[model samples]
Target: MAELFARDTLSSQRWRRRLVPNQSFTLGRSTQKYPVVWDKQISSQHAQLNWNGVQLEIRKIEEAANPIFFGSRPRISFMLDPGQHFVIGHTEFLLENSEPTMPLPHRSPRTEVTIRPEEIRRTSFRKTPGRIELLTELVSKMTASTDHDQLITIALQQLLHGIPHATDVQLLEQSLDGDTKTFSPIAWDSRDGVSTPGGSSQSLIENATTSHMCVLHVWPNEPDPATADFTQIAGHDWAMCIPLEIKLNQVAALYISGKRARLEGNLTEVEILQDDIKFAELVGSTFANLSRNMALERRQSQLNQFFTPGLLDHVSTDIESYLAPREAGLMVLFCDLRGFSAATEDNIDRLIPHLHQTSETLSIITSAILAQQGVIGDFHGDAVMGFWGWPVSASENPLGGIQAAWEIVQTLAGTEFLCSDTPAKAGIGIAAGQAVAGMIGSRDQVKVTAFGPPVNLASRIEGMTKPLGIPLLLDDHAVTQLQSHPSMPPNTFLRLGSFRLSGLRQETQIFTVNSGEIAWLPEFSQALILFEEGDWPQAISILQSLPTQFGPRNLLLQYMQGFQNQCPASWSGTIERNTK
Candidate 1:
C-alpha cells in the first residue's frame, strides 16, 4: 500500500488516503470521482496517479495547465519513490510505501516503547552542539538584539533548526493583568518546508499555569472512545504543550506539534517532550532578561526629558541621595515667551502644532542651559526655570548663569519657530543667591524643585521685562556676582535703578543687558546718575532728546517726566511697583 498524505492548499491541513496496487486515481475539483478535491483553481480533470505493482507514477491530464513540482523543484511529471514529495496548486503530497505483512493465526498486541528520564537526557545531550552550547548561543543573540520582534523570530528559527521532528512552534505571553492572553507566531516548518500558524487545543495560560508538559493525540474524523470528552482542537495529529518558567510565579508556554507520531531510537514521544521543555525554558529565561533591560532603558529615556544629561547620570547611580533636600548657593534663570498666550488664542485650530514649535524653542533654550552645566526646573505654562551650582557647586564660574541667559535670549531671537505667522521672542530673568533645592510632596506625587527668596525673585524679575520693554533683565545680585568674575563682558550690564517690588519691603536694583545693536549705554548711564542725584529736569531733557527707537520705551520717560513735574524736597530715585 502507498500512503498519500494530502495537505490542504488553503488551510495547511493534511489528510491521509491509501493507494492500492494497479489502481488508478484522479485528483481534481470534482468530488464524485476524485478522492482529493480542492477548490475552483484545480481543474475537473487536473491529474491522474497510477500505482503499479512496484512503483507509483503521476501524469498531468488534458485539462491541467499548471505543472507539479517533484521534491523541492518544479517538474511536469515524475515517478514517486518511497519518500518522494510533490506539490500541485498549493497542495502537497508525500508518498510512502508500506509493504503488506501476513498476520499469524493468533497475534499478540505490540508492546509500547518507553525510556527512562536519564536515557532521554543522554540522547538529548549527545547531539552535536549540545544543549548547553545551544543555550549559550541563544543568550548571546538575545542580549545583542534589542528589538523584541526580531529576538522572538530568531529564537523560534533556532529552536526549529535544532529539533528535526518538531514541525511548528509558537510563544504565548501572559498579559500583565493575568486576565487576557496573546500569542506570537514564532516559526512553523511543515513537511513541504512551508510555514503555518500553530493551533491550540486548550487555553494556553491555563496549560502553562500547570507548570508541566502534556501530549495529546488528535483524530480529525473519528472520536476516540478512550478520551471522548476532550475534543482535539489542534490542526496536527499530535501536539505537545510545554510550560516554560520565565520567572518566579510567572510562566509562559511553548506549543509544539507535528503531523506524525513516531519514535526514533530511545527518542520516544515522552523523551522528545522532555527535550522541548528544556529548550523552551532556556529561551524563556533569555527573553526575561532582555525584557528587564528594555524596561530599564525606557525608564531612563523618560528621566532624560526632565533632567540634564549630567544630572541624569548621577541620578541613575543614586536617585534617593541625589534628590535629598539641601541648602546651596545657586544662580536661577526664568524665561517666558513674550506673546505666547496671544499666539495660542489667535491660532486656536493650530494650537497643538503651535505648542510643539514652542516646545522645540524651549528645548533649544534647555540645551543652552545644559551646556553651562545647568539643571532644568519646572515648566509652567509658557515659562521655564533653570538653575546652576546645586547638586554640585559651580561657584568657580559665577558668571555661568548670566552667560546661559544671554545665550538663551540670543538663540530664541535667531531661530524661527515652525507654524507661526510672526517671529517668536522670549524674556529672561537671572538671579544668583542661596536656595533650598530638593524633592517635595508625598511619595505618590513628588517633584524636584528649588525654593526660597531667589526663586521667587527670579519670577518677579522676569515679569519686569514686559514693562521695561527689554528682552532680558536681572537683579542686582546677579550683576554683582557677574562683576566679581574676571571674564564678565565689558559694558554688558546697565544700571536700571532701584525698584520696590510688591511683596518685598526693601528695594531691588534691577539691571538690563546691552544686547541691542544701538549704543545708548553712555547716555542711559548719565541719565540714571542725574536722576538718582535729584536732577530730574536735566535727566528728562536727555531722555527726551535720545532717539525713540534707540532709547527706552515710554514707561521710563513718563516716570521721569512725572518726577520733573512734581519734585518733593525729600524725594528719592526709587521706583515702586504696586502690581506683579
Candidate 2:
C-alpha cells in the first residue's frame, strides 16, 4: 500500500488517500473517484493513475482541457517513483511509499476496564425521585424537540441530573481521513454548568468504536507497572465512552468523566455500575434514531421543490430504478402569463412590487399542477412547465395536464397584481406523447425534465394562444386522451383548426375547451369545418352571420379576405406560423 498526498498550496489544504496495489483511480473536476471541486481549470477525467507496488503509472486523458505538468514541463504520460511529485493546476500531488500510521497511545499512566454490551448485568437505574423526574423529562423533551442541538442539550442535562458521579458530559463527533481521526465536541457541559476542554482520551474513544461497546477508564490507588501506560485523560481519574450508531462513514460517541475521591476536597468515591452504562446507552439510542429521522426530513424537504408527494414516495422506495433516464409517455403542459412584458414596462418605477406579483402568479400555476400530482419540469421567466405520467405512468390520470390547465385559468382570473391595468391572464398549452423523462445532466448538476416532441409542441401551442385569441390550447393527442377519460365532460372540446407551428414539420390539430362560454361556438365550428375544407363561400356566409366582434370569428374572416375571399392554390387549411 502507498499514500497519495494532495496539497493545495493556494489554500494550504491537504488530503491523503491510500492507494491499493492494482486498482486505478482518476483525478478530475467531476470524477467520482477523485474530485477536485476547488479548481475550475481541471477538466473532468483529467488523468488516470495506478500504483503497481513498485511505481506509479500516470496517463493524461486526451479530452482533458488542461495539461499535467511534471517538474516544469507538461507531460502526456510518465512514471513516478517513490518520493516524486507532480502538479496539476494549483494542486500538487506527491507519491510516498510509507504506510499510513495511527497516532501513538497517550504517555500518561492510568488503569482502564472495558465491557461489552452483553457482559453487563442489564440492571435498571435507581428509582430515586430525582432520577425518575429526569427520565420523564428526557422522554417528553425528545418527543417534542425538532432541533438536533436542542435534543442533545436536553439529553446532556438529564444525564447530569441522573448520574451523581458524572462531572462532565459531552457529545463528540469523529471525522476520519485516511488513517487520521479527528474528534470535535458538539455539545458539552460540566456539573457546575461550565465547560472545560481536552478531558477526552483518544485511545479510549478508539476502543469504544472498535469494540462497538462502552469503555471505562479508572486510576486505582496502586497501578501495576505492566498496565500503567494505558491511555487516559490527565485530569479526570475516570471516564466512560459509549459509541453511537450514526450515519455511514461517520462516528459519534457519548463521553462522561469525573474526578476520583480526594482527601483535601472531601469528594467521595462512587462506583460506576451497569445501571449507569444502561441508562447512557438508552439515551444514545434515542438520539441516533432522532438524528436519522431529521436528516431524512431535510432531504425530503429539498426534494419537494421539484417532485410531487406521490412521485417522491415512489422515488423514496426505489430511487435508482425510478430516477433512471428512460423513454416514457408524458403529458407536458406549458403555461405563460399574458401581457407580462407590457406589465413589467408599466411598473418600471415599482419593479420590486411587480416582481412580487409575478412570483405569486407563477406559484398559483405551479400549485395547481402539483395538486394534480404533476412534476414541475422547468421555468422560463414568467412561464412554468409541468409534466405527468413519469416514474409512474399517467395511465391513472391521462387528463391531468388538461385538468390543471383549467384550474390555472380559473385561479388567475381573480388574482390582483400591482399592475392593475393589465389583467392577470395566462395562456396554457398541453400535449401528450412519447418523451425521454427522468434525471438528466452531468454529475455536477442535474435536472428532472422530459424531452422530445411533446415538450416542444406544448411550448408552441402555448404561444399560439395569444395569436388565436384563446386562453388555453391542446394538441390533438391530448384531446384524444381526454375524449375517452371518464371524468371529462362531453361536447367540451372545440377544434381550433390545424396549424404548422413554427419549426414543427408535422401539422398539429389544435383544440380548446368550450364549456359553452362562446354562444356562437356551434356556428363558428360550422364555419371552421367549411374553411378547413376550402369551401370559402359557404364558410364566409356562416362567418358573416356570427358576431364580428368575436375574436376567433374575426380572425378567421381576415384570413380568407387576405386572398380575396377565394381559396388559394395552397389551400391546405394548415395555418403556417412563422414565429413562436
- lDDT of candidate 1 over 3-75, digit per residue (tens): 6666666863444445678888887765333434545566777788887856678887866877777867766
lDDT of 2 at 549: 41
lDDT (Cα atoms) of all candidates against the true structure: 0.64, 0.75
Tens-digit lDDT string for candidate 2 (1-580): 4667666768634444557897898988776546665677788789999999889899999999888999789999999998899988998888866531222355343556676765543554533446666667787877776656556766776777667767878778887677977766655656655234345777778888889888776666545556553223334567778888653325789888766633223322333434566667777767777776766676677669777887776676566567888998899999999878999999999999999999999999999999888989988898999999887789866777887888887777432221123444888899989999888888798877888899999999999877666678899998898888887788878887889999999999998887555566788888999999999999999989876445567678888888899999878988778899
Candidate 2 stretches greater than 4 Å from native: 1-121, 126-129, 157-196, 199-212, 215-240, 245-251, 255-276, 293-327, 339-367, 370-383, 413-424, 435-453, 486-491, 500-507, 517-579
TM-score of 1: 0.53
In candidate 1, where is summed lDDT lowest over 10 consecutive residues?
100-109
State how far residue 294 of model 1 sits from its true place (Å): 2.1
List, in order, the clash count of every candidate structure: 0, 1
- C-alpha root-mean-square deviation, each candidate: 17.2, 14.8
- Alpha carbon lDDT at 28, candidate 1: 71
Q: Which candidate has the top score in TM-score?
A: 2
Which candidate wins on lDDT?
A: 2
